[model samples]
Target: MKKHFLPLILSFLLFACGNPKETNNEKLTIVTTTSMIADVAKNIGKDSVSVTALMGPGVDPHLYKATQGDLSRLQGADIILYNGLHLEGKMGEVFEKLARIKTVVPVSKGVDPTFLLSDPVFTGSIDPHIWFDVSIWSATIKEVLAIMIETDPDNEAFYEKNAIAYAQELTDLHEWVTNEIASIPYNQRILITAHDAFSYFGRAYGIEVRGLQGISTLSEFGLKDRVDLVNFIVEKQIKAVFVETSVSEKNIKAIIEGCQQKGHNVVIGGRLYSDAMGAEGTAEGTYIGMVKANVNIIVNALK
Candidate 1:
């Protein structure tokens, strides 16, 4: 048992090393856990700061374990940002250690609890995937703005301007999502994915969401869970079920097979960016782009 926990313990111990190495450059060295946060930093910081994401596209934050290289990047980072509420469960120790000496922050820190969805499996833990709902993500933008300005006070004016512009973009995105969802016929608005990451998305958009596993992918999917989900999807005659970019498609395949066993046909709607975003350089790689792509896929499949 000790051997099994040794890796995470070793990683956390690395934070006790001296202060993060100075880049000796003008840019504010920012390291983020997810691509969404990295994109926001880039958008707000622009050319003023250098932003890096430890988990790239198709990477699931729930199960992400730090490598030696990742620990090096975190230690050398001037500022580190992550989604709180234990989203990065494996890195909790390291984040706590870094908080003692560095300005490590969680993007969800500024979000109002009234707007947050509590994780059913984890007591007192809120779902950290706020980017799905553009309205909720605006709160995260504010958090990013505050930190960026705090880290680089000299460029306060520029950061504020960029932040305001980005806020408006989120407003537009929120409206766009609402409009897109409204266009889909009433009962067909259900969003079924491999995991329960989209509860926030469903709550914000007024769609019903269900998943085989719990909110976190770390939870197991059993034979009973499979049968129940198949029954739900079949009972609703849900036209399509979706898979996630970060999670394995095996659960989805099993669900389809179960449905087939009962003689109901279900096709995979399309892959949605859940825990992670699309590959960088593509439209879905960016936060806004990821949301739009997901909405398009959902609407196309069920409509």
Candidate 2:
């Protein structure tokens, strides 16, 4: 028990080392760990909540560490939201500290265990990339909506109204993705990427997915893993393998080179939004836009 709780102990010790910041009382300040979570919070909260994402576009949450500045922001926020299932592995201790004093919540808390994917490499942890499956992700909105209402009961009706609209958007996006991915030839539906971040996506869209690495970017890939994936691609004659915005491209590049060595020309389909979304002002920044962008790239290259 002591060994298991060590990270939380370290986090508490480090909290006193960071400088404090002034708290804003104008609106509900929600600090999220990833761009997708921030986008969802923004959609549900609308202009009533101010959100800050600790991890930016193309940032990998699995390897991200909390800086003193990040600590300050988390400490100052009225509500903290993160996609829990060990996605923010390094920052788990920090969140444990905040949970004691603030309204710290995991967006995945609302998802059913039956719908979650278990990590094959890890003993008990589940996959954290719920945003890929719009249907599973829609369940998270209820968690966010409930928090928003509880924190500010005066605007309960307003928050409820926005939650309904956001839920509908997710439903429509799920339908769009299902229909769009169906156009790909049954055999050509294999999706290869740097890591196993798209299992939910594959399950939802009926695509056969493979990754060189494990579910989390923290898991490293070996030569045997690379060679096996390359062999699979050569055997299957897969046209394109995708690069994730949040994961390193070196491994994917190596896979491409390996395929070339085997006399198979596998091109990079396109960059997919995996762990993180696109820039704030862009279409891909939003959850719906991110899914559509990935589907467009996958279908165009594979078809």
- Candidate models: Cα lDDT each: 0.83, 0.85
Those runs of model 1 whose alpha carbons end farther than 4 Å from true positions after fitting are 1-25
**Native-vs-model 1 lDDT?**
0.83
Tell me the spans in candidate 2 whose CA falls farther than 4 Å from its real position.
1-25
- Give candidates' CA RMSD values in order: 10.0, 9.7
Error of 1 at 26 (Å): 1.5
Q: After best superposition, candidate 1 residue 158: deviation in angstroms? A: 0.4
TM-score of 1: 0.90
- What TM-score, over all chains together, does every model reach? 0.90, 0.91
RMSD value for candidate 1: 10.0
What is the overall TM-score of model 2 with all chains considered together? 0.91
The residue-by-residue lDDT of candidate 2 on 1-303, one tens digit each, is 212222322222211111112243487899999988888889867777899999999999999999999999998998999999999999999999889999999999978788899888888989888888888887777788778878876666666666766776776787899899999999899999999999999988899999999999889778899999999999999989999998889999999999999999999999999998899889998888999999999999999
